[model samples]
Target chain A: SQQGEEDPQALSIQEGENATMNCSYKTSINNLQWYRQNSGRGLVHLILIRSNEREKHSGRLRVTLDTSKKSSSLLITASRAADTASYFCATVDRAGYSTLTFGKGTMLLVSP
Target chain B: EPEVTQTPSHQVTQMGQEVILRCVPISNHLYFYWYRQILGQKVEFLVSFYNNEISEKSEIFDDQFSVERPDGSNFTLKIRSTKLEDSAMYFCASSEALRETQYFGPGTRLLVL
Candidate 1:
């Protein structure tokens, strides 16, 4: 069973706009990580936010985690056509299990 | 800047045949994992390996699936008897330690007929 669920299954925006995707999980986690997948290719790790952290930034990527709400959000600012891809949120539970439980993912389409 | 690498980007096999999906994880990494994503579906965790043994696995990783680290760098996923439902993209990932961020490979698209 999937522990996390993402909102806005699909999003379309023009290039240079900001894209935001939200994910909610049901269990306590040690950390939450975001990844990007291009079409049928592999996933690229974007960023990871630990439970104690509220926000993190890596280049154009920003991730915010709200442990109280059991949710997190990924924001890609000034999106580009190259930024178009499926974004997934994976949670590593506090049980010390290294496996990541991924969400269904949100597909973002950036049109140039 | 090192990344995980997978071989045979695409593979096709008949049902009941055996297939081996190979991966070379980042050097110096200790934990390795396997994941699968069916077309139009979310990625699912298959198994995790550490210290040359299975650490954890999901129900989807039944007896048909097995993992091995033949040497120090290569991690492989072998399916004993492939099924049509097995057609999906298999991904291999590695991390420096438990609970750390995992680096993913390009993935192998397996198509079982």
Candidate 2:
């Protein structure tokens, strides 16, 4: 079973607009990481935020995690056409190992 | 910029036949993992391997599934008997250490007839 669920299954935005996707998990997590999948290709790790941290940033991407709320959000600032892809949130449980449980994912479409 | 690599971008097999999905992880990585995604579904974890043994596995990984690091660079997942329900995109991932970031391969699309 999947531990996390993402909201706004699909999102469409114009270039330079920001895109936000939210995810919620059911159990306690050690960390949450976001990944991007381009069509039929592999997943690319974007950002990872530990349970102790609330927010993290990488390039134009920003992620905020709220353990109290059991949710997390990924924000892409100044989106571009190339940024169109499926975004997934995976949670690593507090089970001592790093095995991840992923969400259904949010499909983002950036129009030029 | 080393990355994980999977073989035979696509594979087709009969329902009762055995199939082995192969992967070559980053040279120095210690942990390996396998995940699958049915069309229009979330990615699901199958198993995680470290120190030449399985560290963890999901309920989906039943008796039909097995993982092996047969050689220095090759990690393989063998399905003793494939089933129609097994058709999905199988991904291979590896991490340099436990509880760290993982790198994934392009994935192998398997079709069971």
For B18-39, candidate 2 gives per-residue lDDT tens digits of 9999999999999999999998
**What digit string (tens of lDDT, one per residue) describes model 2 on residues A2-65?**
5789988999999999999999998889899899999967899998899999999999999999
- Grade the docking of candidate 1: high
Expressed as tens digits, the lDDT of each residue in A70-108 for candidate 1 is: 999999999999999999999999986898999999999
lDDT of 2 at A7: 87
The residue ranges of model 1 lying beyond 4 angstroms of the native Cα positions read none
Per-candidate interface DockQ score:
0.94, 0.84
Q: Highest TM-score: which candidate?
A: 1
List pairs with backbone clashes in candidate 2: none
Candidate 2: lDDT over CA atoms?
0.94
